[model samples]
Target: MIWNIYLIILTYFLLGGIGFYLINRKKDPLVARKSYTKFIVYFFIVNGLFFSITIEPVVFRYLAMVITGVGMVELIRLFKISGYSRKSFFATSVVIFILLALGFCFFATLNKNLILFTFLVLSIFDAFSQITGQLWGKKKILPHISPNKTLGGLVGGACVALASALLLRKLLGVSPVSLLFLSAGIILFAFLGDVAASYYKRKYEVKNFNDLIPGHGGFLDRFDSLIAGGAWVALYSQLADI
Candidate 1:
């Protein structure tokens, strides 16, 4: 598991560096440099610590959450310097941490089915959202920000997510009812997360959260869905177990 985690981090950094180079090629050199710097710092502080927390105990996890919460606040503050102020962004981050902490406290004993379902729901939605948004998106889903997003893409992504959930259920032996319901929740929340990230980027007058991935945007850009999806999964898993 440790080796797998290390590999994942290495892959993320390598991919992120490629994105930085690509976007930088078209933009002002100074802006690109700053973006890369921000990306690395943000990735290390947020994702690095996050993975560490996952491998640590509950105490360490809480500490990691606190750090992440602070990091989110700081990132928002940085954006605000450019003229964006959406209080809900920070609020949601806080709420997510709170919920996750609660789950750790209460639901750690639950069956892996609940956890697996949650992860499957999140992963399917996230993968489908990106795939669909990239391929079939047309009309702007949010014109003010994230102009590339489309209603068609959203629907397509949801359909893909549903199909993926069903497939996972068949292969992984998850309950059909649970898979269906979880997939629905995942689809809705994944959309919410994507839109929210778009709003944040637009409000800050920036394109992509940070240039950290090759063919992808930033750490936040890639993981925005995971943040919300993971939190929702943890909470839902806990509730279901109860």
Candidate 2:
């Protein structure tokens, strides 16, 4: 089990390094630098998540709380920037932070393997969705909300993510039936999370949730999919007993 975790970590960095390097190649120096920064920060974020899960459940719970607290701060800032009234902000914040807290708590109780699987699916889908979208996405699916999301990108990313899930079934010890549902849940929720965040950004007239993570904008900006997708995975794990 431990070896498998290390393997996933190795694979993540290898693929991430190659992908970022290729994408940054031939780009303007400043642009490439920004891309490099994004990649570095992303690496840290991914590893931090991995560490949180691999450690004791109590540790994971505390880490999750810290993350939720930071996320709430960012959300509060967004609400203030958007001029939400105090009542509205407090109400919305309670609802959102509650859901976010529950999501993280549920996630902490998941089987380590399942947690890793959820991460794998989200990472692949998130990365490929944007890559294919940029390379071949012409028709904007949500132009007003998320201008860059396209049908081609969504389709391409889903296809690749599904394929990868199947290919990793044996390694991950996931049955085919469970893999199908899990993959679907992760992809759908991840997309919804992205769209949901984008909706707020558009409505608030903000480019990102915040500028906390440099190129990644903020915790919400980067991990919205994980929050939503992980929650689905946790609920599905309970329901399906996977």
**How far off is residue 237 in model 2, in Å?**
2.0
Which residue window of length 10 is worst by lDDT in model 1? 103-112
**In every candidate, how many clashes are there?**
6, 0
Candidate 1 per-residue lDDT, tens place, 7-125, comes to 54465457556655655678787877766665666455545444433444354445435534543654565456766466676567546545543543343233444434444455545
Q: How far is candidate 1 from the true structure (C-alpha RMSD, Å)?
A: 7.1
Clashing pairs in 1: 15-213, 15-214, 16-212, 16-213, 19-213, 19-214
Instruction: Provide the lDDT at 142 for model 1.
Output: 76
lDDT of 2 at 235: 82
Evaluated at residue 27, the lDDT of candidate 1 is: 77
Instruction: Find the candidate with the highest lDDT and give its number.
Output: 2
Candidate 2 residue spans exceeding 4 A from truth: 1-5, 55-57, 85-97, 170-174
| Candidate 1 local Cα displacement, residue 12, angstroms | 19
What is each predicted model's overall lDDT from 0 to 1? Answer: 0.57, 0.77
